[model samples]
Target: MSQLAQDRGISVDHGTAEDLPLTTNEIDLAALLGVIGYVNDLEMVFSELARVVSPDGHAIVPFCGQMVLFAELYDTAAGQEAYPDTLDWKETYPLEMAKKATWRDVEAVVSELQSVGFTEITTVKTLTQPIETAIETVESPSKGHDDGSWIVVHARRE
Candidate 1:
């Protein structure tokens, strides 16, 4: 086995999605930990993951939600509109990596992943507490903002 083979848990440094070391119908799970935003191709990567995953396998992807808020904030705070121009693709990336971070919309991300061949898609949103709610619920001095919302999508291969 190659280093890529050993990187299943750490990181699979394959040349490309098409060249992943895993054989077809072998992988039980394909997981993307906030990585989709950096990939150049969404459909192809999803297709490759689907190909590698077994019929009974599942893919878990966690990404940012509604990054527009962060982008707009960064643009305004930094006085630049095109600071992070790379995050414009909602499917592949987000709008403006210029912010301290970016987020994604749960519905849209899940829909895009499912349309590419994933089944039984499910999404969970994290860090969505409002500023007022955070203070009341958690009793923390730090106020929560909607800016850090995240989405996690899980789907199975067909």
Candidate 2:
């Protein structure tokens, strides 16, 4: 990841989310996209985000694969067996990886942001691309479907 970021000239640094290598109230904006899917300590991560970003800065941050398959998240409740409306897609990777990763939906992300004291919070425009038609609405999910497949939370540091 560092190599890729470096190649793109994005000043990427390796550090823990709980303890960021940055000063207080230093950053104007922090684009934390798709982070909670990997980290279990959501509060700590947001705390760090809040600490690093300026008072008005925001962070974009989760997941059902049907709406956003980029993360390849596997949920028992979202499986074909459970959700009959779930689309039929073959497993792309080993089941072990699925077992290890902790999957989190948008609701969880929103909860974390609220817990972190983010008041001016609003979910960004959810784009369930390729899968959801341009005319379709994500708010009202289709049959055997789930809304808020992907979420990018833009939360202002109040």
Candidate 3:
């Protein structure tokens, strides 16, 4: 992916957190946008973010939650029988996991990031409405449903 971006004239830096090739405090902004959920250890990544980012440097992370309606659907459906564990479901139904962003879980992520030394938490709530209202307001003629909502939280490493 970095190579593809480089082909488009974008410079890329590649390294693991254990041996970050970038100089300390060199990154001004870190966008974990729509990514942290896919990681095995979110807290570890946040620690890396704190280590690499300068004071007041921004880290924008967009993650999904567990309380999303589709997740609820999975929880209430055969998924319970199919996977019996969240990890199994995550692997088997990746799209569902991707779309299952929720407030409670995302806030937990925020708290974890804060504990890892990132601060100045700011959250943006996007695409939220009561399920019933969403079902009624959706204009698509083919189908109508309320699948919950998503959020984008922006924070900084202090």
Candidate 4:
């Protein structure tokens, strides 16, 4: 993706979302897609985000709750019979193991952002979409779902 962006004459930087490769206070905005749900160190991630973004810049994070990953698959009758133990799912899907993995709903995300100096937090939207059109589908080799909703949390640095 970085290569494609560069090829199109757009600047690109190869880096992890938790640890941006850019210099301090250089970015005006940091738009995170759907990856924060899987990041283990949200505290650290928010710290890094604070360090890099201008004091007044913003970070737009879209929160996908644990249900986003476990829904449909784990919410079914057969799923309960076969994967009844969420404990077992920890080994299978480690994201489920972390305390903040699911963001505990959007409020958690807002709290983290506030702790890290972000303010004006707002849940822009929380809407469901057909899973077939989303990232993980029933045909997916990994965990798939029939439908899911995402909570988009938008906040500003101050």
Tens-place lDDT per residue, model 3, 6-120, is 9999988887643456767888887765566556666777788888888888887755455775345445544444543433232344435534433347667779889977877
In candidate 1, where is summed lDDT lowest over 10 consecutive residues?
135-144
Candidate 4, 1-158: lDDT as tens digits: 77888899998777886778999999889887766766878888888888888988988786555555444443442334444443323333322333334333565677888999999876644324444334342332222212335566677899
Q: lDDT for every model?
A: 0.61, 0.59, 0.61, 0.63
* Residue 105 local lDDT, model 4: 54
Which candidate leads in lDDT? Answer: 4
Every model: Cα RMSD to truth: 8.6, 6.5, 7.9, 8.4
For every model shown, what is its TM-score relative to the native structure?
0.59, 0.63, 0.64, 0.65
Residue 158 in candidate 4 has what lDDT? 93
Q: What is the lDDT, from 0 to 100, of the residue 70 in candidate 4?
A: 43
Off by over 4 Å in 3: 15-21, 73-104, 130-148
The number of clashing residue pairs in model 2 is: 2
Which regions of candidate 2 fall more than 4 Å away from where they truly are?
A: 62-73, 76-97, 125-146
- What is the TM-score (0 to 1) of candidate 3? 0.64
Query: What overall lDDT, based on C-alpha atoms, would model 1 receive against the true structure?
Result: 0.61
Best by TM-score: 4
Kindly indicate the candidate among 3 and 4 with the higher TM-score.
4
